[model samples]
Target: MGDTAVGPTDLGPGRRQPLDPLDCGGLELDGALDLLAAGELTVTGRMTDASNATLYCEIAAGESSGRCVYKPIRGERALWDFPDGTLAARELAAYEVSAALGLGIVPPTIMRDGPFGPGMVQLWIDTDVTVDLVALTRSDDPQLRRIALFDAVINNADRKGGHLLPAPSGRVHGIDHGVTFHAEGKLRTLLWTWRGRRLSAEETALLRGLAEQLTGDLGRRLEPLLTVTELTALDARLDDLLDTGRFPLPSGDWPPIPWPPF
Candidate 1:
């Protein structure tokens, strides 16, 4: 089976259960006072406007320590137009999938049932750590190039330079994956600038492995997080990119890079 066909179970652990948003209060969410910075008090003070009614909170914790970030689901808002709350769910799912694939991703600190509804709590990342594409494309780092290629293969629509945060240890972590793997097509930010470039033996091998597993039993296993339609679309997108035998380029009018690293 192609990597796209491979089910979640095929990768490793079965699908992770959705986190209960309510369980986070005072514990993983509101708790952990010592881990926070001096100015930080509680989640109530940090709430910021996210898309729609959904709110995003920054825990005001220092960079080195794990900081709590909360995402609350709101209703009937176009900016937050996720009627099904699938976007939040999808973000969680992507983190889980990337973890299973051995990619370095920021894992959720906690998931709990909220007063509004199901919500998520995750580690706050440094807004300054993100590298702009203009800077990245100008660099001589082969590792960065490889990382960019990996982002392409994964259909990371929002792989803006700002999204790639370099930790104190120098490892890069991608964030804000709420809009990934839509049933329609790959639509979002553009990062594929190396299309048609020759793939190294290692790259070829990885793609081949991923393709074989993506659409088979593995796809079915991801059903809990992704609909069959979404999974099928994901597999098709990967297949198209692999067949092109080229690096991806900016797709549409969307800016090739993301702005405001924060």
Candidate 2:
């Protein structure tokens, strides 16, 4: 991660989540990001639920002890298709794209060199564990639907139920976006409840706005993280969603659902 990236700088606490970035002791999102970027990372635990290398770490920036997940680039296992030491970059890119789409779904994340090597550090979200995600995925909840559409736009290959964390304020936040924005049709998700359903006009407008941003600012932001082919494919995905105007069917290349669904 040579890019020296900052995260969620201007974001104020607009969402109703339990812990908003800007709500912590009146600190700005930029302050939290600076902590994640330059603070001393103390690895506390291992997040074994994820398929890749993930660690639960506490970042100490002065008096603040911020909890975050640290995914080091050196810990990333090699993939036959994707390049090496790139998953952490992709995770930061996902946060940027989500911010560009005007969604506060992805938690604050930044790219920095940690104890393990160059990696990503993202704020730990406190979730409502009592909510039945299986039930949520089976319903017509607009929250899940929006996330589903967002997954399609990014060509996310993994949307496991564990990744869909519901906040205390009823908003569902998506995390672990390492395997996303692929050039090929590699979408494999468990969110198929609204299959073939037409999107609301409001949602359509959001998509249109996202498409516009892709051609300009979002494209520039993702250039360092993703390849040119991936960007072109992302553009094609926006066009495809606009043309179809409905929930997409799963690509037959792989199974629609991820293993160990929850």
Candidate 3:
């Protein structure tokens, strides 16, 4: 299940509403990142439906307090295909890529020490409850198109509809990025509306910039999070995408979409 940023509309008559983004001390990008990285983290609750131990947390530094999600390394369940305890790093790496791409689709995320140990901590995004996620997933929304492009570059293995958080502010935020940056072609997602379509100039330019960055700072930062082989595969995927200048058609090698997609 997606780690939804809970709000009043999502709760029943008596259930406590989780902090709204404003209630969590509303900070801009840099402030939020600093708070997530250096603040005192306190566990507030857990999302039991998540595959791993996903903790809801409150982080405060000085007077800035905000709600965040913490996924501890030790809490990670062993996956046969992925290296043990590496999901947190992958999540952080995904955020780095998103930031480098200038796509704010990902929330401010960092790998930091939490109460349970080092893990991925990210700012919580309050969703617009009125937006129909299922309908949105199938729509040809431009934002989803950008996200689909991002997934292709990062090799995101999971991109279910439920993972999309349509924020009240009109921006979309995607979560649950642990299963990404693999060495193989594992780009499973719901945002395939542009499959085999020609890439726009903007999208192609973004890919070019990303390819350049992967050879510089972004590559250095991702080194600790992904294997050398995975990084090589990432470059190859970018090269292929740029070469084709089109969204890829499903390869038919693996399940193209995730089960229980929403």
Candidate 4:
């Protein structure tokens, strides 16, 4: 895979109480995970068809609890490309970068000690299951467009159709990011419909804002999570994108689209 910040160590507070099914989504994320450190977890046995041993879990801390997807470090299958035992950390780094870029496409994720040792935990997204991947891949919808740009910046190696989850509020959350943030140019995804297209003035403005943050807060936060070489490559990608002001074309030297476009 192509080669990936740092962010808050906590969220979730205010006397955690059991949440109503729909209420959790509308709740304020402002410090919504500070209490996750002391939660109890139970595995549900449900899982995705990924290479790693991922688990669906319910976390109960105080009277409050919610479902989360957990990926433990020890359970990670060995990969030929990525450094072993680092995938869980990469997953958190992806969320950190997504938040830094102000895309809000990744769900709130945290890295902590779990039953299977250290791993990443992300709040389960209650998605609008009716979203059509076929249409979404071709649509010019601004949100999807933003995700396309996000996948590029992170050098994401897998942007499968199932990873793009749309919620009722129109927010699309991207998941399964363990294979991302390589120091190399390994951006394989299903978001090339906008290839060669110029970014809107607004989009360019956001990119510029993110570039500025990378040098300060974002960079400092990321230093602990990624290698120096990887961070340097991220800066280079930002510069390249800003200079072009257009969606990138598939490189002739590497794979562009991810397997299983759906």
Query: Evaluated with TM-score, which candidate comes out highest?
Result: 3
Error of 2 at 17 (Å): 11
lDDT string, candidate 4, 1-262, tens digits: 1000122554222112222234234434443454344566677875767779899888776766777788888899998888998888778878777776656777767787777777787777787768786787777788788888988888888888888887767777788989887888888888888888998888788778777877887777677778898888888888899999998889887889887776
lDDT of 4 at 231: 88
lDDT of 3 at 167: 83
Q: Per-residue lDDT of 1-262 in model 1, one digit per residue for the tens?
A: 1011111212244323222222223224223323332223234444434443434454434542334555554432343323366555566556655543444453343334443444444555444335465676456456455556655644555665555655544445566666666665354443445545777777666566666656554454456667777777767766776677666666565555544423
Instruction: Give the backbone clash total of model 4.
Output: 16
Give the candidate order by descending TM-score.
Answer: 3, 4, 2, 1
lDDT of each: 0.50, 0.77, 0.82, 0.74
Q: Any idea what lDDT model 2 has?
A: 0.77
For model 2, residues 1-262, the per-residue Cα lDDT tens digits are 2333344344432212233543233444566666777678888999876668899987776776677888888889898877887898889888877776667778778787777777888887767879998888788787788788889888888898889888766778899998898888888888988778887788788788877777776667678888999889988988888898887888677888987777
- Scanning candidate 3 in windows of ten residues, the lowest lDDT window is 6-15
Q: Model 3, which residues run further than 4 Å from truth?
A: 1-25
Q: Model 1 compared with the native: what TM-score?
A: 0.64
Model 4 Cα RMSD, 1 decimal = 5.6
Number of the candidate with higher TM-score, 3 or 4: 3
